[model samples]
Target chain A: MSTQIPKNLKYTKEHEWILIEGDTATVGITDFAQSALGDIVFCETPEVGTELAQGKTFGVVESIKSVSDLYSPVSGTVIEKNSDVEGSPEKINSNAYESWLIKVKVKNPGEISQLMTAEAYDQFCQTSA
Target chain B: MTLRTSLYQKHVDLKAKIVDFAGWDMPVQYTSVKDETLAVRKKVGVFDVSHMGEFFAEGPDAIKFIDSLVTNDIASAAMGKAIYSPLCRENGTVVDDLIVYKLAEQKLLICVNASNIQKDFEWMNAHAGKYDVRFTNKSEHYSLLALQGPESEGILKKFIPNLPSLEYYSVWESGQTIIARTGYTGEDGFEIFGSHEYIGKLWDQLIAAGVTPCGLASRDVLRLEVCYPLYGHELNDEITPLDAALAWTVKLNKTSFIGKTALTDYKPKYKLVKLLVEKAIPREGYHVVDENDGVIGVVTSGTMSVVLNQGVAFARISSDKFSKGQNYFIDIRQKKYPATLVTKPFVQGGHK
Candidate 1:
């Protein structure tokens, strides 16, 4: 079953969710992504000062079953990292959107246009399934 | 194009993730390996081990015939008792490690790995010409299930009324089913052997009684936690039972047997050691390196442990290369990560 995606957020084809509010965008994995990964055992996040390009793998999330890379949705500098997620990665499986991994300061706000809308992402997941 | 077991439909019905392992379609996991591992440790869980092979040996000289093949003393085993033994070649190399259950003086049951079933049967039958014993490969006709955990006894007692009274490493036959209080997992469990037709019903009965259905993923982690030697990992054709630290099972005091001469003259150059990596997870085929960045050995089985929450691996390293508390490096994709050699069973005594 497909999970409900927030209408205001943008999504990536790699199953990452981006919540843009002003110059800073919060990024986390989708609920569908966490369920597919099973229990989250460990997470490796990029450094706070590291700069990432859009569609580039910045970190990795390892669950009990498999390990998946987390791709950056917008090209920017990572301003904040989730310390809570580093300690207890299982929080991502419980609430993916609330447990944001990184908050990146947007370098070019126009890059958000490349992400799919909520309706588009829902249809994309359906077709892929 | 791998062989599927009889419980293939049941596994698919439970939404299990299936994978091809050693030429058999097996369930890797049903929900999560971590949760299933914890369940078996604290409560109860059941596994579908029908892919394993079972054989029956009968006749007057069954004990004599089997004693000559395996490294263990099968003649000393009383009826209703089981002993783990290794079948070796003339060159002191292990063919397969098996559990031989003595049902009576003339009847014995042997459980072997699925991949080596045919070869092991051929080896046993070839040597049966002198003895009155006859070997039969009953793998296709039997299904094996393991009910393991601390609460396994309570759950199993509901079906088999006398199950809780049976001692460890003992076998009791109930009609067509053979119930043995032994399992690969380091827990208080029982391995039930019976026909495939009745196993589905038994599985449903256990599920109805609140026993969780676990898959091979959890089974591997459970066995690893106890430092049990797997076939491809710790035991292989080139490695002798003595080299793998399984010399306790080998009875060299006995009379002539296969590999006895070579085993007496053999001196192991390398030994198996459990390596614990901090922060860095070592995987299978990963090179084990020394302080000078010289490769010494390779990792056989590795995984991110749920209990330890770190990377644990079992590797065969040069005996004189490293000692306890000596640090080494594992080349994980060109990055040399730090690791240390520790004793087997990263986790200490729970059950065996």
Candidate 2:
């Protein structure tokens, strides 16, 4: 199935995506990630004010079939979590990018250079599949 | 490496996510578990259950032979009728739970779990040698499809006109297909048994007839919603039917059976109960704890229920510790979530 991957976003090997604007990065799962996980039943995200290092576990995304760990793409402190997900986790299934889990203040702005671009991530997914 | 069923190609064509289940390459989901599960509950859904085993027993002593093997009274089951029974070891421990269909006075058909095909066949054969019965394993030769839902009867009536008349737990042969009003999912459905080659056409016909294709992931959730006991979870060699709350099928009056002696002395120590978690999804092997934070038992099978839209689980808890309306806790990861002990089925989606 074809999934939407915004060109402006950066992705991680773990399938999480970050949309960086200034010092804050909006975090959510990629379309490829949501489709792979199937229906999202529950999402356990890191609380606000929680500090996370690059490549560190930030939360968990659980579907009917399996549970996957959500990794932070960039080092940051969690500033906000999506309260909509707390009420309706299925929002992630509908539009994964729009259903951002957390907004974090980027610890190191240059660290975004290490993340893969949308095209690269799409190619990575194809190779892995 | 595990074996693949004939429908493996169909799963791939549908872009289903395939996973290794009980040493078999099976489709975990086709579209989505939520959609497929809702389809089964509302309309109709077809499933590829060919990985399950089918065995044929026929001869002069067929009835006598099967009666000795299972815990249910096969002699009372009329021709064209099917009964669910448990095959127990000498110690009253459940080896496997199977469905036995009486085809004729001298012939019977047995359906067993996919993983226990080889072992079940060997066990049945060893016991058949002492009697005038013939056992034939036809699991590979046949393919089974389950069409289930409230509207399943309507879809099936388009092909077989008299399908509605077939009573529950009864089997009828219509051409090459043996249609049985039985299914694993707690819904009114038919289990069609036919040759491997023709089964594909039947699946296509059902799809053309508007039956959604379902996979193992939805099937597991559907069964869990109805509180149906799975083989490895609710049953095992160390657990008895009495403990699993399936004593209704065990005929204690039977003079001879594999587990008769042990069953006579069996007492319930642990009982399987259904739990509805308020916040978390309790998975298999998760600890079931009491209100005092003492571990009592472990969860056997659990999933995010589609019908209830909540987490449901079946766990074997101490009989003394289990009580109605009592709140229990399930340890998911490191967090303890409150769960409640309810009736067998967490949801009543018309499986009465």
Candidate 3:
């Protein structure tokens, strides 16, 4: 299956994607994560104002068959939590890139440089598969 | 090394996700687990269950010999009828649950769980010394395909147009093929047991006819929703039939079975109960706690119910420590999620 990796986004090895806008970063799982997890039934995201550490678990995404931990790509504090995805987790399965889970104010800008580019992420997924 | 089924290539051709199941490389999903689950609930789905074990018993004393081993009275089961029973050890604990199909007065077929194939065969064979009977392990020679859901009968009619409707738990045999109106998904379905060559052809025909191919992940969700007992999850050597809410399957009055003496007065210390959790999902090994947060049980099997859009589980709780009117909660990740006790079969299907 071909996964969507937006050209404008940066990715983590854990399959999370981030779209930077100024100092804030919008975070969500990649298309590969959603398809791999199957139909997501429940999503638990950290509330706004919650602090996040880079590569640390901040949320959980549960599908019918399995549960996955959502890791933060960059250390920051959660400024927005997507209640829309919380109410309807299936949205992530439908359009993962569009269903952003959180928005964070970047704690350390250096972490952004450590993440993967779209092309690199595509290659990573291929090698892993 | 893991074993592969005859249809392993076919599953790969269909782009199925393979997983190691009981030492066998089996398909866990073709599309998505939820989609395949709904297909079986609302439409038709085909499943490859050839990993299950099959044993045949043939002799002039077949009925009596088989009847002496199981808890159920298979001697009374009419020809072409299938009987479900538990093979128990001397201590009244279950070894394996199997289906006994009486083909004739001198012949019968026994189907068991995949993981328990060798154990079940050895247990049965060791006890068959005195009876004039012959047993053969024929699991590798056959393939089992289950056509399940509300649309199953309609789709099967396209293949066997002239065949009559089979009653529940009834088998229709023609040569080496046996089609039984039996399934684990609680749906109006038929389990077709035949040679691998015939099953492979039928699988292609069904797929060409647009029937969805389901896998083990969906099968687990479907069976759990219907409150069916899985072998390793709900049943084990330590669990008795009474503990698993399968008392009806144990006919204690039958003319002296293996566990008759022990099961005659058996009272289970633990009882399995169904729970409905709307907020959080409970998984295996999760603790079941009471209102005071005291642990009282453990979850055996659980999943997100697609039909109810909630979490459902089977928990084995201490019989004396829990009450029907009291509040129960499942401890998931150190958080207590309230659980409501529900009746058998969290979802009803089209089956009788």
Candidate 4:
């Protein structure tokens, strides 16, 4: 199954995607990540105002069989935590990229450039699969 | 190399997510486990459970030999009857949970867990002890097609014209097939046992009839939802039957079984209880702690209940944990999630 990687988003090796818009960036797991973690039951995200370091575990997404650590693409402070996704974790299964988990106010916007582009992430998913 | 069942190609053709389960290359799901689980509960679903092992104990002393090894009474099982029990060690610990089918007065067929096929054989052989019976592992000879749900009988009745009056926990032999009205899903279902080639053909027939092929993932969830005791999780060498809440499986009056002496008046220190967590899902080996933050016991089996949409799990807690009537918490990922004590069977059984 081919995973959907949107061109507008930057992705981390941990399969989290960051949509940088000004100082605030929306975060959610990529489609590839959600598919691999089938039938996600719970998503525990870092609370708002929580500081997350680059490549650090900011949250956890639990599937039926296993649990995966959701990492931050860049160092940032959590601006908003999606209560909607928490209430309905299956939303990620329906559309991973659409159900944003959190919005982080990026401390260093320049670090977003270090993440993989949509094309690069798609190729990475292929090789990994 | 992992073993492949007769329905492996069919699962592959359906674009199933295959995974290594008990050293077998089995499909985990075709679509999603949640969807598949719902289908089985609401409508109908078929499962390829051909990996389970089958053994035959045939001789004049078949009843004596089989009864001595298992915890349940073989005398209670008449001809063409199936009985559920655990193969226990001498010390009252379970070696494996299996079902025994009385093929004849001098013959008995046993269905065991796939992973415990070899172990159960070895244990049974060692304990036979001059019972004048021959134990043969016929696991490779049979392939099981589990047609489960409210519509299970309707689906199976289509092909088999002469439907034998098979009751629950009873087997009926019609030519080369053995139709047993038994399943772990707590549903009114049949485990059709036949040759691998025959099973493959039957699988195609079921799929053509629009039956959803469920995977082991959903099977585990469905069984857990009904409070059925799974071998490795709920029962083990160390976990007694009473500890797993399977006291019904142990018949202490059974004639001189392996674990009879030790479990004569056994009272388990741990009690199996169902819990519903707030949001976070509880997993195996997670600590179940008391209100005082002391580790009381551990979660044996856990999953997110599709029907309840909440974290439901079975944990083996100490009897003393409830003496003070304090609530319990499951320590998941270094965080404590409060869990409410609920009755057995996290969901009301939808079985007919």
On DockQ, the candidate that comes out on top is 3
B285-335: candidate 1 lDDT, tens digit per residue: 899998788888888888777788888888887766746666778887577
* Candidate 4 docking classification: medium
DockQ, all models: 0.39, 0.76, 0.84, 0.75
The value of fnat for model 3 is 0.88
Model 2 CA deviation exceeding 4 Å by range: A108-110, B162-164, B174-176, B319-326
Q: State the lDDT of candidate 3 residue by residue for A46-125, as single tens digits.
A: 88999999989988999997889999999999999999999999999999999999999999999899999999999999
lDDT of 4 by residue, A1-129 (tens): 688888989898889888989998899998988998899988899889999998888888988767899888888899999999988898999999889999999899889889999999988888889
Q: On DockQ, who's better, 1 or 4? A: 4
Taking the tens digit of each residue's C-alpha lDDT, what string does model 2 give over A14-70? Answer: 998899999999999988989999999998988899999998888888998678988
Candidate 3 lDDT for residue B216: 97
Deviation of model 3 at A122, angstroms: 1.8
lDDT of 1 at B167: 81
Q: Identify the runs in model 3 with alpha carbons over 4 angstroms from their true place.
A: none
Better of 1 and 4 by lDDT: 4
Number of clashes found in candidate 2: 0
**Model 3 chain B lDDT-worst window of ten:** B160-169
- Which prediction has the highest TM-score against the true structure? 3
Interface RMSD of 4: 1.1
For candidate 2, the per-residue lDDT at A35 reads 90
Error (Å) of candidate 4 at residue A111 is 2.6
